[model samples]
Target: MKRIVFSAMAACMIVSACATAQDGTGLSKKEKKAGWKQLFDGKTLTGWHQFHAKPGSTPAWKAVDGTLFLDTDAKASGASGGDLVTNEDYENFEFEYEWKISPNGNSGVMFGVNEDKKYGATYSTGPEMQVIDDAGHPDGKNKKHNSGELYDMIAAPKFYAKPVGEWNKAKIIKKDGKITLFLNGEKTAETTMGTPEWQELLNNSKFKTWKGFGEYPKGKIALQDHGDKVWYRNLKIRQL
Candidate 1:
């Protein structure tokens, strides 16, 4: 009987391990083998901070229920809710995250963001992967500004974002000057940086006059506050 009980306990342990491996906030065995690292840790804001915040300022973003979410109420109450940026800069990497936006909300995930006092906003230096409620937000009417597009540079061929309140999977991969964006398992946009074509697109976009927009080869990743409610989870990255 003792032997049988020991075997059952071991089985339970195995099941628990498997369940943990499949947790949304954790890396799977395969993901670990492939060198994926969890960025958010599903608990605390350990490796992130507000963009251009003074030293020791508390971030207005919250981590609860395995989500990193912007506290819009705090912003509405006049709290300093700036864009959140990764503590570490990444170059030539793949980043994936899940996001859920409120009705008529707006937000974005930006890469190559230069955190400098000279640049007043995160979008000033980094290009954005647009995030919004496609069915509710005014920006949704412009395909270039819809969720998953490369901000105003390239438009998604078709709407690929889920409705408001539903989580959508988003991925950005940048390698060797080429970047690709994916939303809900569909490729939304792709562009090669530093090319004449890229320069032409930039010249035609709103960022044309912005001195350093989309010019960084290595910079921090940012999550825009946009004065809107948004939640993000499962943020992971793999360096290329």
Candidate 2:
């Protein structure tokens, strides 16, 4: 009788906990139980660093009001900070984050980014999930360059994107060489890497000129600084 009562009480507590998860904050208990780790603590850039900022200089990125933002106007002064990258490398994983771009802003979230002196830019290596103002940015003119698309490689099927300054959720799932992209609760793109289909896409795109662009089976994730103001938060990753 005591064991039955204890079990009932635990179930009730679990239900209550799931109802109160605060979005854009730290990971929930359920997420932690499922092996999810917080990439952004909502206050600092602890696990990330400037991708190519000059030695011993601070990146032109800021964390404010629980959001990480890049100042595009400041970056235009030639004090460029480049992109931001995770300190750890991941091979197959699920990554989710929320972002909002200013009017006419342009940015991207990249994975499979390799850090080598030979690579002049992060997009040269990693595949980018383009982030831009769907209606305001010039890239928005092209379906393939809009938010949640695979940046000139694959167009996101569902073109549902919120307006500027409104937060939008995006997800990237890569496991066993199959990659999937999600934007605002909709599946945007899906593809498999290293296959002939992928090869053809690579051949058609400009990335073919760059060696080993998306061939890496493992690499760091990156947030782009495309000389545009952008805000990001609620970064969470779970290894699959």
Candidate 3:
């Protein structure tokens, strides 16, 4: 009878451990084992700060209800807001996040972002994973500007973004100069940087004249604030 009681207790403890691992806002047991780390703690903006803002300035972004969201009201009122960027720079890493955009919203996730004051904007250095309301945003009409594309350089074969207000999963992987992007479990774009093909694409794009665009091998990740409202959660990254 004592053996039976001990076995039941052990089973209950195992179940509890699994439940803790499956918490929505944190890395799962499998993810932790795979070397994934949370970029957003889901309760605070500890790991991020506004781009180009003075140190210790209050960020225009907010963390509420397990989401990191842009305060459009603050931005429209000219209350000190800009793109948010990670404090730590990453190179050759895989990043994953979930996002939901407001109607007609436009924003992006940029990687390889150089934070020097010389660059007026994040896009001047980093390449963006386009994020917009495909059905309402004007930019969505162009495949290259749609969500999950490599911004203006490489267009996705088809639209894979969910409707506005619905969360969509996005993944970006860069390893040894090769980059691949996925939207909602579908591969959206792939490219190899520092190649002739990459140069040709850059030369043909709007960033052709922008010095240092997509040239850095290591830089911070950025969340763009394009005068729109958007919510991001479950931001996690693992270095390759």
Candidate 4:
């Protein structure tokens, strides 16, 4: 069944091509407006990819009551892995999404990913925009669990996360080697990518053991399911 579905999709892609404009991460006014485009239509997963295990099954992600929900209940049965990635690849861009985590839930949004199934997660190559329950999760005690942190690596500028079970806004801008994290309309963290300093940091971190992490110039965006219920919506992006 999965093969049949993927074959049909493959057939369609061969017949038609869909292109989206940029997210305008660091472009001038004219260039920004010219390339800025949306990735989600607010209703479907037309441009995303599920993990390798379910190559042909519909993603566990779904729209419920106008919001995107990542169901973890069904995941325990036979989930290949917890990464769901965008069908499109991006270089530099600004991405925004609203999310709500269940009490004690843990999840993440990653970018600058060079997706390869050999690795355990999207984080293997992409820097994650930490999504966690700051008031309930174990990592909450640490700054990395905050709303805008870089997930165990770089801390967010400040704590701005709402209580568990409430929706919070988050954004990530990646461009020209610089990365910025924003939460609920406030800037929280900023860092450089692919720099000697960053490499040094990775060299001393868990990612140090992972091969090809952040080696690609561009790749897909991804969502994680860490055995927690997570909700997302109003996801939009513009390239630069």
The per-model lDDT (C-alpha) reads 0.91, 0.87, 0.91, 0.75
Name the 10 consecutive residues with the lowest summed lDDT in model 3: 19-28
How do the residues 14-133 of candidate 1 rate in per-residue lDDT, one tens digit apiece? 987874575554888778778889999988999998998887666679998999999888765656789999999998999999999999999999999999889998899999999998
lDDT of 2 by residue, 1-240 (tens): 999999999999988878657555576766887889989887888999888656777677878898888976665575557899999999899999999998999999999988887888888889999899988888799858989988888987668689888999999999987889999998888889989988887887878888969978899999998888899998999999
lDDT of 2: 0.87
- Poorest lDDT segment (10 consecutive residues) of candidate 4: 18-27
Selected candidate, larger TM-score, 2 vs 4 = 2
User: Alpha carbon lDDT of residue 93, candidate 1?
Assistant: 98
Predicted structure with the largest TM-score when compared to the true one: 3
lDDT of 4 by residue, 1-240 (tens): 999999999988855432222233322344345665555656676677775545456556775876778877665664344677888888888888889999998898887677566766677788788888887888788755566787767776678888889899998888887888889998877778778877876776667877777677688888887878898876778887
Cα RMSD for candidate 3? 3.3
TM-score of 1: 0.89
- In angstroms, the error of model 2 at 39 is 0.7
Q: How many residue pairs clash per model?
A: 0, 0, 0, 7
Choose 1 or 3, whichever is better by TM-score.
Answer: 3
lDDT by residue (80-196, candidate 3, tens digit) is 778999999999999999999999999999999999989999999999999999889999897589999999999988889997999999999999889999999999989898999
What value does the lDDT take at residue 13 in candidate 4?
87
Higher-TM-score candidate among 1 and 4? Answer: 1
Better of 3 and 4 by lDDT: 3
